[model samples]
Every structure is written in C-alpha cells, then in structure tokens.
Target: MLTRPISEGNLLTEHNVHQNYRPDVDGLRAIAILGVLGYHAFPGEVPGGFLGVDVFFVISGYLISTIIFRSLEQKKFSFAEFYAHRIRRIFPALILVLIVSLLIARNVMLPNEFAVFGRHAAAGAGFVENFVLWRESSYFDVATTLKPLMHLWSLAIEEQFYLVFPIISWLAWRTRLKWPLLVAAIGLISFLVYVFSSPISAFFSPLSRAWELMLGAACACLAPKILAPKSAGRSFYGSSFSILGLFLIGLSFFGSLTTSLFARPVLINVMATLGTALLILSGPAASLNRLLLSTRPFVFVGLISYPLYLWHWPIFSFWTIIEGKSIDLTSRVLAVSLSLALAWLTFQFVEYPIRTNKRAKFRLATGLAGFMALAVALGLTAGHWGRHYDANIQKIIDAWDFAGYPEPPGAFHDPKYNFVSWRANTENEILLIGDSHAEQYINAIVASLNSSADRPSPQLMFYSVMSRFGIPQDLLNKIANDQAITRVVVSYFWSIKYGSPKIDYEIRCCGTGLFQTVGTKGGSSPSENEMRSLDAELEQLLTALRRDGREVDVILDNPFGSDLAPRSLVRRNILSGIQINAGVALSRAEAIERTEPYRSRVREIATRVGARVIDPMDSLCNDTGCPAITSDGFPVLKDYDHLSLSTLIHHVGYLNFLR
Candidate 1:
C-alpha cells in the first residue's frame, strides 16, 4: 500500500502510472475531509473545519503538479489525455449526485426553491458555480443554506484552474524556464491579492485563490530537488518539521489560530496549505506520519472524500428545509452517517469502476454527454416551471402594488416617499427616516394617506436610514437646516439590522475615529448589556430629535412570520393544487409570540423618551393568524418579513395610528 516505512531521507517518493500509490496522501485527505465534514455538520464542534479545503488545495496541487511535471520532463505529456483523465476522475460521481439532487428537489422543494436549485445545477455543470455564488453573496452568508449545490463552487474553481494551469505548465516547459519558479512567481502575485484584495472577491475569485493551488504545484515542481532524501538533514526534514506541520493543521482545525478572513479568509487558509505541504513532503518516512496517516481507515476515507464532500452538504440542506430549521445534533450525525454510506457506495460502484476502466473511456465520455443532457433538461424544466410561478406572482403584485404613476423628469420619486417631496407642497411634510425596515411599510403609509379625505394631501420627506444610527447625522443635519419637515418617523428591521453579521461603523469626532457599533451576527438577539446600550442609543436619538422640536414616532417592527417568500408559500400550497391551513407557512399566534421581545423593547424605549410608539403588529395581524395570501387569493408580502405594497394599499383602514 505505502512505500513500506522508508528509511529516513530515502523517500523522495515519486508517483507515476507504474509507481506504488501513496496511501499516506490518501490518509491526509482523510484528515481534510473529516475537518470539512465536522465543520459543515457541526460547526460548533469544528469551527475551523473549513480549513480542510485549504489542505485539499495543497494536496491537489502537489499531486497534479507532480503528474504534469513528471510527464512534461519525460516529453510524454498530452493535453487530450490530461482532459480525458480529468473527465473520468470528476464526472461519474458528480453526475450521480446531480441526478439525485434534482430528483429530490423536484418532489420536495417549492417552485422558487427548485428554480434556484435548477439555476445552480446548470451553473455547477458549466463549472461556473463559484461565479454564480459570488454574484449572490459571500460563501459563509446565510443564503448558502438554501442552495443544495453550494459546495460545487469549489469543484468549479478547481476545474476552472485545471483548464488554464496545463497550458501554463506546457509553456514553461517549452520555454525551458524552471516550472517551480514560474509557478512560485504566479503564486506570489496571487498571494498578494489574497492578502490585500477586497475580502469577497479574494475569497471567491479564481484569480485570488490560484495562489493556494500554486503553493501545492510549487511543492510538486520542486519535489525532486528540495524534497529529495537528504543523508544529513534528519531533524529538519524528518520528524521536527512534520510535527510543526501537524500542529499548524491542528490549530487551523480547532480555530485556535489567530488568523481569520471575513469569518472565511486567506491567512487562515495559509496555515492549512503550509501544513498540508509540509506533511505531504515528509512522505511515509516520518514515523508519526506513517503510524497515524497511513492507516487503512484514514486512507479509505480519503478515497471517498470527493464524493463525500459533494453528498454531505445537500443532505444537510434538504434536511434543514424539511425540518423547517437547522438540523439537530442527532439529525446531523444521522445525515453524516448516511453521507458516508452513500459516498462509499458511490466510490465503489460508480467512481472506481469508470475511473479504472481504461478501455471503456469512450463509454464514460458518452455517459457524461448523456448526463449533461439530463442536467440541462432538468434545469430547463425547472426554469420553465419557475416562469409560470413568477407569472402568477406578478399578477398578484400588479393588483396590489401601489406605485402606478410615472415620475416627472428632473425630480426623482424616492420609493420610500412613494411621491417626490419637492413636487408635492412640502411646507408641512412628514419626515420619514429609517432603513429598509422603514421602507418596508411605505405602501401602508401611502394607503393611509390616500384614504384620509379630510386631511390635506399628506406630503412626505424621506431621508434614507442606516442601521448603524438610530438617528443619522444626515437626518440631524437636514432637520437643523429644513423648516419643511416637522415630524420624524423612525422604522427599521430591528431583528435583522441588530442581528449578527454587522459591519463596524467609525464615528468621527476629531482627527481620529472610534467604532460605535459592530454588527457581528452571532444569534437573533443581543446580550442584555448590548440591549441596554442599544436602548440608550435609541433614547439619545429621540432626545436629540425632541430638542430639535420634531415630533418623533418610532414604529415597532412587524411580526416576523416564516422568512420564506410569499410566492414560495404560494407555490408550496399551489404546487399540489391544494390550499391547506397547515401549509399556510405562518400563523398570527406564532407571529405575535415571536414579536414580544421586539415590542417590549420598543415600548420601553419609546416611553422613556416620551416619543409615540406605533405598533403595526396589531394592525396588520390578528389573534387568529397573519395570512400571507389575501381573501381573493392574491399574496400580500414580497417575502415573509416585508409587507407588500398592495397588501398595505388595499388594507389601509387598519392604520389607526393615522387617526
């Protein structure tokens, strides 16, 4: 299996078609896969488990570079053969996973969810999943949970790199330049970008992630020269460096290491990459490496790591969807056990057979083509289904959406105001100041104004809100200067804005700056101390507004129903052509129960500041339930959290606050 416990400094360990397969490398893959599996299935157990991907990059680079360099050096490298090998190695298991995923989603997921899945499936097939996800959100963003094909992004990145790297290697060989040096140079440039580029682009872009791969390639390219068994450098190459490497890997796995990037970044990745390279270079000669990593169990896992990675995430994601929340530990363990079984079976029955059968390569190619067709057809069918769902959603939207009039040239109608402030007589305009949370209720406010026959046409002045400020400096500045605005209504999505994944805001007082708040998302609510501080911040804003002689009304956040979009719920009900209350997505009682903390906090702060607290939860919802769809079968919300303009427009009399 392994180069049987090679003598110290005698295991330069070259691998080719004729060479013994390194079971130790497979063992290292085991470590990486475990890290990934642990992290995904139980992040609390393995927060740094993602570093396994870094380990994989290094292993992949070294293995690939070793093959390419050895072939090129011997003048036996072929592009056709290389790509054919790639197709064989990659597609069989992947196609199986895709087929199964599509089938499951078609039966279980709503039209919106399935539509998203279908789009990602096509992107995954094209090896553009990373780009598609990058365009959507950060890798670690909450949006990742819904996309069953999310992990395919890495495969896409690796495949995209494979397309370009061979040509680069070939050119270096042709030019008689040192391949290692060329790769190192390219890697250095990429590393710089990794460290300094915008976190999002750096994290997702192939151009930035290339360095991690290059590091492995560099290791392989220089293996013969630097990793050669040295007669004298026993401690340097044997146990000492290998131990340090393992330590680094452990540190990364435990997330004990200080380095981090956007909760997912480059420096932490470097630790795993470097550690994997060192351990790989140590070969099977190092006693510790041989004892632990070259074992059968570890090697078996390594063999199935690729397929396991593919199957695990989707299983967890779908389980979450089914459970209507995150999977519990028992479920996670069950999912992992099932994933391992599927992966092993897939590896044995699917991957090993097709990968080993050299003569049946043409058959492999034909099967791949057929699978591609199936994937395309699945994607097309999903999209076509989605279009019908969208058309229904659109008809509902048209009937309920309030903004029908076009804006006059040169005076923009801010959607928040629903009408241009300057175009309308603004001498007695109501000032609205808040983020998208406030913006969510624009239609409700407009509909109330439209029905008030006795009141002067209610002109509104809108100032965009930032979550970082309860009362923005811009709003304060506008109020200090403008006489047209007398009243200020504050609204925001308290749950989301105050929730984790927040940005740090720097408040400028002098030449220097201090961070006022950092919205690092950890959970739904803040700590008691943080809440007190937040309460104080609201009071400060209200007091300042009152001092400026402006009437301030703080509208309480609406009840958070099922966060799934209304169309999604509609699809769930209508997908089966059966309207069931059990499938309504959210009940008013549940919404009210959840809104307690928000309403209590808002009322507490409003009372302290002597400001009017507007609670819309009662107006929009009742004791029975908050229906997403209206009596006429038109949906109300754009999604679960935000109120649809049409819903507010049609149901305006609910606003007793306007009285």
Candidate 2:
C-alpha cells in the first residue's frame, strides 16, 4: 500500500505545496507522555492520567485510519502489505523490550513469580495480554503488581480492534454502504458494554475497551469532511479547541476515579477522546499544532513511544522486586530514565534494522517464532513445577488436618493440613465441616484425638469439607454415612472482625481494609438463604448423629485478637535487640478480650444446635490485664490471633476440658 512520493508537478492545488509538519502534534505527545508518567509515578498527581492511554488510542486510530483511507482511495488495498506495515511498526521494538526485561527478571524474581512473568510474556507475544490480565483480576493477588507487561493490556486491546476495523472498512468500500453508521454503531455498543462492566473489566476485557479504539476509527471516517480548511480566522477556533482539549485532559487527570455516578462514567474517556480527535484534525491547519509538536526532541520521543511504554513497566517492577521496595518518586524517576534509554536503543538497533530492510523479514519471522516457542516451553515447565510444589505442600496440610484445632496458622507451611480424610473405614465416622478457621485447627485436634486420652479418638473417620461463606446441605449428605457417625465436630471462626461494616466500606473504596470495624449498622446483612442453609446443614448433622446414638461436639470458635501482635513481635525479635516474651504477651486478659466476641458467637450457635461449646479464651487469659510478654518469653501468639505450634504444644496440657 506504499504510495510513491508526490512530485510537485502532480499536486492538484498549491495548498499541497504549503503543507508542512506539525510541531504541536509532538507537544500533544509530550502531554500524553507526561500525564501517563505522572499517573504511574504518583497516582494522586493525576487521578485520570490513566486516560492518557485513551489519548494515544485516539491518535493511533486517526493516523492509521488516514493511512488506510488514503491507500484505499488510491486503489491500493493489499492485506499482506497492510499486515507487513503493522508487523514492522509494532513487533520489533516490543520483542526487544520483552527479551531484555525477561532476562533481567529471570535472574531476580522468585520462581513462582518469574513463572507468571514468562506466561504473560507469551500472552503478550500473542497480542492477548488483555485476556490474561482479565483472568488475573479475579484473584486480585499481590502477584499482579510485579508484572511489567501488565500495561501491554492496552496494546492488546488496540491491536484486536485494528484487526477487525480494516476488514469492515474494506467491506464498506466494496458494498458502498453507510460504513460510518455501521462502524459508529459498533463503537457505541462496545462503549455501552464497557460502561456496564467497568472497574470489573477496567484494564482488560477488549469488549469493554473497543469503544476507545473505535472512537478513533469514527474520527477517521468523518475526517475528510470535518478536517477541510476554511480561513486563517478558522485556525483560531481550531487552535482554541486544541488548547481546550488539553485543558480537559488536565482536568480529568486531577479528578477522582469515583466522581462519576453513571456506570463506567465513561464521559471522562469520551471527553479526552474527543479532544484528541480535535487535536489531530486541527493539525495541518491550526497554528498551535504546528508550533507545539514539531520540535526535534519531542518528535524523537514520539517516534520511540511504543518501546518506551513496553520497557518502563518491567524495569520498574524488577527494580521493586530486587530492592524489596515500593514505587516512590525516586523509583519513578529511575524507571523513566531506564525506560527511555532502553527504548532508544531498541528503536535504533532493532526496530530500524528490521523495518527498513526487506530481507530482514525472514530473519525476523524466524527469530520471533523461535523465541515464542522457547518462552512457551519454559513457561509450561515453570507452571508444571509450581503446580507440583503446590501439590506436595497441600498433601502435608491435609495430613496435619488443622480443622479440629481452635485456631489455625494464618500461613500454613503445609497444604496437606487443609484436607480431612476418612479413617481406614469410611463407614460410621465423624465428619467436620466449616470455613477455613475451622479447617485451621484440624491438626491439633487430630493430634489430641489420636492421643490415648479421648476414647481412642473413636477410630473416627473425618471429612474436612467446608465452605467459606456457608455450606450447602447436599454436599454434607454426600460425605455423611447413612447411620450417624460416632461424633461430628462443626466449627467456624465467629468474629465481628469478619463482618465489620467499616472495614467493608474501606475495602470497597480504597481496595484495602482500614484496620477498624465498620460499626454494625452500615453494611449489608447476610442473606436469609445463607443463614437458613447453614442452619439446615447443622440440623441435619445433629439429627443423623442422634438417630445413631452418636455424640456430636460443635467446637466453639477460638478467639481472634488484633492479628497484629504475632507479626509485630516477630519483626521486632528478628530485626531488633528486644528480647520479647511472646507467651505472656499473647496471654494478656486484654488480648483475650479481643477474641471474646467470637467465643460468644460460638456459644450462641452451640445453644441453638444443643451441642457442647468449648471455650479456650480462659486458657489465654487470667483475672489480670493481658501481658505483652508470655511467661516463656515466646511471643504468646504465633500471629495476632492464632497460637504458634510451640504455644499449642504447650497449651495442649490445659485442653483437658475436651476429656
């Protein structure tokens, strides 16, 4: 689709001769880059600077649309040629950035985290980073912050949009239909979907993002009509609109992400998008465009913007991983400097050589394919290794069976401790059910059960099945014997901490808990169905046990204090010279008071179910105030609420209440 350079004699009008490059376009690039940089560096600096991506999106749409429209109008529409231009323009620098960053991170990141990087790298090469990111959002894990290629989700959205836009453009040409209307409708519908599903689909999910790209496409189709020159006076309006566009963008950057009431409140994106379009159309005519973007340095940066975007994130992420630090102003500056250096090198050495040379296509294709295959293989290997490690750890947790204990470790070393297995004989056995807190104490209970102290633990077979929020009775029946098992222990942690209204609001607003209870009044209450289901499950278990003349013990929840002491004590002991006593520290009456509410809830549930309630709060507290130091000088609790293994082994002597 390449057009021969227009000779002076071939021009239809003198206006073509006077046409010149626009400097303001470069200034626009500077605006977009600065906004994006500020947003990433200090998020509060420009709340909506994230929209800078929308600015770039519009520019790409306008430029590419112009090129495609011009080529088609000139009777030059070759798919192979179109794709070649795209490959040369995008891949060379992207591949270089990925390779360099992967090498750097491979050496520094933990194996599990490094494996995730490799997988994302593969997804990026396939131009589906958006899909990968969409899947990751559900977990909302800490692992996400470490990914540098996370930003590539936007690139994926743009590429996918372009892939389909041209075919529609070509169809419009062949049929001579109202292509703009059809295209605009597509953009509108995509935007509606985006508005409906945002924050959920924020950084990923192309369906929600197609509108941004299409906004540019629509601008392109309408360009010939809107961009026609008028008079010198008209340039004033054009320049004013251009400046106005920048002002709107600046305003968005300063606005809050939460200000909009309507879904997605995409008005912000729309405004910035419209502004970018105006900026583009204003070029070739508006004096502001010519004066702002035509500078040598600005043009240079714009030329390498693709690579700059690709390199910045990974370098920043790897730096954070290496230093075990957060992203601060200093880190932002370093990241930007490193990104610029890498982008310049990539553009000059890799992109230029590959794009300008025709024969280099073969070499480029081979290298790309080989690199892709290698990355896939390595990623698969790493993933398999991680899965295997998880399996082995899970087995240990299951073997430990921590569900029966009053409190379980917040972080378990073994995954096996998670499961409940049947005794040698599955028939006529006890089954345990509840959420993680119930599961957490399984090991100690199992240990106590196996001890010669409690009726040979009844040769009891236990099933550790439980739900996080509530359990369904159907699953309970599936695991139960026809006749009641010897005894069943039902357990869960009952704490206001779990249902605190203020913590919920903070979590919804700031994406994290605020460390205080949201008093009981403000939050939504649990549904009747959830409560009924829990009640039904308990009643069924009790009925079945009674019919078989079996005893049932519903373990009362252990207390959960601030969950701060253990973490605090460990940090102090490891980092400082303070010889802290953990036991007395953990056993303080005040420390025990924090868990009293959970114990009360357990007692309430026990009364409702006519089951025995086991309260361990007194074991952890005395008549006196809670002591920060345990009598043994071991931190009283392993974590803020749960006793450590050593603490548990010591406390086992006091647990004769079970006997």
Top candidate on lDDT is: 1
For 21-127, candidate 1 gives per-residue lDDT tens digits of: 67778888889999999998878768889888878888887777777788888887777666766777888888889988887777556555577789888888878
lDDT of 2 by residue, 1-659 (tens): 11222211222221111123344554666667767776777676577777788888877676566556656666766665555556656777776666665666555543455677778887887788888877765322333445778788888887886687778777877776664775588788878888777675854777777777777767667756766655531467777866776666766676565465312347777777777877776654566556556565667776666777777777766665554335578878888888788877887777666665655554565565566566556554554543222332222222221113443323222222233352333333455656654454455555555564535343333344444433456645543444534566666654432443222232121111221112122455445565456556555555554444445566654444433233233111112212222333344554545545445544665666567666555565556644433455444344334454544655534444332
> Residue-pair clashes per candidate, as listed?
6, 49
For all candidates in order, the CA lDDT equals 0.67, 0.56
Q: Kindly report which residue stretches of model 2 are placed more than 4 angstroms away from their true locations once superposed.
A: 1-23, 139-143, 230-234, 257-264, 284-287, 323-325, 358-378, 381-435, 450-659
How does candidate 1 fare on TM-score? Answer: 0.78
* C-alpha TM-score for every candidate: 0.78, 0.66
Model 1 clash number:
6
**For model 1, what is the alpha-carbon lDDT of residue 435?**
75
C-alpha displacement of 36 in model 2, angstroms? 2.5
